[model samples]
Target: MAQEPDPERLRALEARLAEAKGSKAKPAAAGKDFSQAEVAWRMVLELTSGIMIGGSIGYGLDYLFGTRPILLIVFLLFGFAAGIRTVMGTARDMQERQLRAQAIETQAEHSAGTEG
Candidate 1:
């Protein structure tokens, strides 16, 4: 048979659980600190995937038409172009988001200052 639980320990556990629940309401201050390496990897993958997809399509077309090199080269170039375009877009988007975030933070500070 199992021993009875200790009442004092059970109350302590309950209090700890309550404290944890209360702490969950506060927003994390460091949550915005995303890793630069992670963003770099994401950009690299996007560029490579675009290139790979273009190459694959070109290869398929070349095989179908029995024009081995021409279609493949054309498609590879197109894919590289597409990847460049995507990377440019990603950079622009990241810049816009960063600007927006800064604007919001600035506005919040302004409001807080006025209210105080």
Candidate 2:
């Protein structure tokens, strides 16, 4: 006579299978759900922070040197330039990351196709 299967073990196996199926469907939806607003906000934050930090440093230096306005104005402009540079750098980095991610995904698909 064949041995009876354990109900507890069978339930555990079913639960694992369901969990695996659920997980496989989530990542695609998560990727699609990513918003452009997030990227915009990230760049804005980077640019704003750079400008603020540079301006503060310039102001401090001006105060220390007892120069009323010249260094402050110069450093403020420098800070604005720095902020723009930072935003551009951030944009480039983001593009690179996106390209890398796409390349990885393409490679994965190719390998999967070959294997199948």
Candidate topping TM-score: 1
Taking all chains together, each candidate's TM-score versus the true structure is 0.69, 0.60
The prediction achieving the highest lDDT against the true structure is 1
The lDDT per prediction is 0.85, 0.79
Clashing residue pairs in candidate 2 (N, C-alpha, C atoms within 3 angstroms): none
TM-score of candidate 1 against the unseen true structure: 0.69
Error of 1 at 4 (Å): 40
Question: What does candidate 1's lDDT look like per residue over 1-116, in tens digits?
Answer: 99999999987887787798874233446356456787788789989998999999999999999999899999999999999899999889778878978997899889889999
Q: Which ten residues in a row have the lowest lDDT in candidate 2?
A: 24-33
lDDT by residue for model 2 (21-60), tens? 8742233333542357987897788788877887888789
Query: Candidate 2, TM-score vs. the true structure?
Result: 0.60
In model 2, how large is the Cα lDDT of residue 87? 85
